[model samples]
Target: MENSFLNRIKGKEFIFSTLLVAFVTVIGSFFRGIIDASNFAVLFLLAVVLSALWWGMASSVFTAFFGVLAFDFFLVPPYNSFSVSDLKYIYTFVGFIITGVIVSMVASRARRQAIETKQREARTAVLYRFSNEMAECETTPQVIGAVRKNVGELLGCSTAVFMPHKDGISDAGSDADFPLDTHEYAVAQWAFSNKKPAGSGTTTLSAAKAFYVPLETSLEAVGVLGIRTADGRVIFNTSEMELVTALANQSSVAIQRAVLTEKSREMELAKKTQALQAALLNSISHDLRTPLVSITGALSALSQDFEAVDAADRKELLQTAYDDSLHLNEIVGNILDMTRVESGNLKLNVRPCDLRDLIGASLTQLKDKLEGRMVAVDIPGDLLEVPVDFSLMMRVFINLIDNAAKYSPAGSEIYIGAKTEGNMAVMTVKDSGFGIPSGDLEHIFDKFFRAVKPRQVSGTGLGLSICRGIVEAHGGKIWARNNTESGAVFFIRLPLGDAGHGGRD
Candidate 1:
């Protein structure tokens, strides 16, 4: 139950004062015959002390007034009437009143100081609680929501948090009931972007309905916090502003920590992936090379004994051995290229080169595979030269051509074209083959990624990945897009070299 002001005044101290006054009156009445004038004075002084001890100065003054009245009524010479025949009784009453007033004055001053002290301690406790709650928040949204709720309770206001967004500022946890206006959002966005407080109590846009304080840390402003007092005025006093700023700083730190943690996780995952790729490369290289070496050695030995071997057997052995070597070489190359790319060790020797020459070299290298496939090349004489690493660029074209041949039906047309687009030299290798599945378009360049439908084709699924790495190393980009007219079109875009340099070769 609440202790009312009157109840506090009439508590134990008030009762004690009343009882003491009554006791003194009774004693004076009983000792009237035995007690001398000096005894009355002593009894009055005892009453004054009791009043000061039990009832504070004000109560003491009241008690002294009653005590004087009792002294005269029951112990004065006239015996229990208001009439005091002696003038000394007047002196005694006056003396008692003066003492009570002095005591009350001193006690009242002490009580005022004590009350002020208690209020200060209460405010300190509130600030401590606010700080503790803010420290426990982790993300920007969490911190904003917590600050809004706590500030609303602490300051007795409707609080909102406005975070910076691409369009403007959005309220952190606002519902339909607390819709934000466009001007308020714009104002909040301005405050956050500029790291300044505006609206209401602030100097900038003081007429604004709500107070906006920038949530800033050491690095930058994270967002803005807005508060509206119950009376519809902003309540961003100095202390309140300081508390809000502190909360905002803590929030910024939390956001920064979260971003750093996410980046750290990404780096760790990349490291583990690199380690796995290295192990796989080691295994593939070892397993594929052993049989390849043995088969090649057997071929050499048989060729030396050609006269002793049957003609048909020698031809079959030579052909089988040749095909096996090619397959093993392709697998080994894919593994090495993948490992290099994953380790970030692939280096490009970029120079201005003719796209026609690059395409021709790739075609020559894959001639045996493309023997039954129809190849069509369309290159203008005035086509711009592109800056690229000749050897790696050729390999990219070779991979694309070989992939096209493997997927295209026998005797299907394959198109190779070079053209210029804006500042880029564009080369497209298109084939009338089974189009890439729509779901696999994005992952086509990912290591070890292959479409399920293409499983029948022989490949380690690293060809496109290697092609991407090589093209990117030369400051170019390669991508696959399904041609509306026919099969998939693999487009390579390389920055055009200076006209005077022709093409880096």
Candidate 2:
């Protein structure tokens, strides 16, 4: 847009300069009889100065040369010929041309400075907008995308950015967009390695098809930016090359910022993972020791006093040993199941199964825990069978029921319900216990995350996390929320149609 406007103005200047010279010649002719030839030469000089000031170098020089010709033919003593009547007129013509040339040079220099100033302002505005856009970019891909968009628009060329990784530079899968053969890639790598521009416009590797510029900052080079014009023409004039260099510098900073952000996130994740491992170790050691101690004590007592202990007391001790061993077994099983889920090694045996049977098995297993609680089941009799891995889904119910029994107070009611809605089977387990804290609701299913407020209960906090993993693996989802009245409700929603159809590994 700016270029077209300047071109139109230049064209008008050409026409106006020609007309002004011609108008001066007509006035000189009308007064030739009265005015001296020297006076007419002065008038032509005035026209030359005005042309130089107003219409710039080309127009001023054109008017100077043409006006001198008209003066000799119309106002000089020899009115119709290039031949000078006197030797003095030759000096005047030569003087006129030299003065006009000098003035035109000065005027053109000033015009060049003005045009460059305007272009600099334009480049600054473009760079400022690009910097702002890049500042908002938080990821490496986003920064690259912004680079492609801005560079493509600014230069009207195809652009590609290659970032360094541990293995090597990543092309970002831009082959179809900006294809580079072995030689072109070598040129790009050289630019990056040497921290210099290469390829078409640069002195280095000038024969290459695309211009390769290193995206460099004060610290280091982050990547290489490649630009290829469609016609394979060299288009990087002095000002444009400067603009591109400024853009590359800005992009380098943004890319470095994004890379640092990604590294920071990885560091944070590693810190969190270390913390989780420590928690797992502590929970496993405590859980494993408690049951082992109980079993050992019970067995030692029974073994030492088999004859001396009374029959009823003997039976009680034996039962304690058995129950503690079962508890120990459950702890080990939970750890193994969690490992399977985490490692993506848990394979499903998909089959059609009734929800009632699964709930029955879960309740029977938890009968000892729910001894005093009033349990209610509300599964509809006509509910259809669900496709799932029977064993994994059964474990889901057992964990939910057992978790409810642990959290809820004895004698409080626990409700288990299931129903189908729009091809999805929704099951819920509600417990009349102290509800989950609002702040902890979201993190409840995170591995090893126990409720902060309720500290009375103790177990490895892996059951709900395992449940979520299993449910999701079976094309389902699970979530928990507190009821308005009292306690908390856990909901599991599974797709009834073709869930676990492929038997996931």
Give me the runs in candidate 2 sitting further than 4 Å from their true place. 1-63, 66-99, 166-168, 173-175, 344-374, 379-390, 419-426, 452-458, 472-477, 494-505
RMSD of 2: 5.2
Q: lDDT of model 2 at residue 404?
A: 84
Q: Name the runs in model 1 displaced over 4 angstroms.
A: 1-260, 263-309, 452-456, 497-505
The whole-model lDDT of each prediction reads 0.74, 0.85
Q: In candidate 2, how many Å is residue 11 off?
A: 11
> Model 2, range 222-271, lDDT digits (tens) per residue?
99999987667665777778889999999999999999999999999999
In candidate 1, what are the lDDT values of residues 425-476, reduced to their tens digit? 8889998888788888999998767764464476777899999998887778
- Judge candidate 1 at residue 422 and give its lDDT: 76
What global local distance difference test value does model 1 have? 0.74
The numbered model that scores best in lDDT is 2
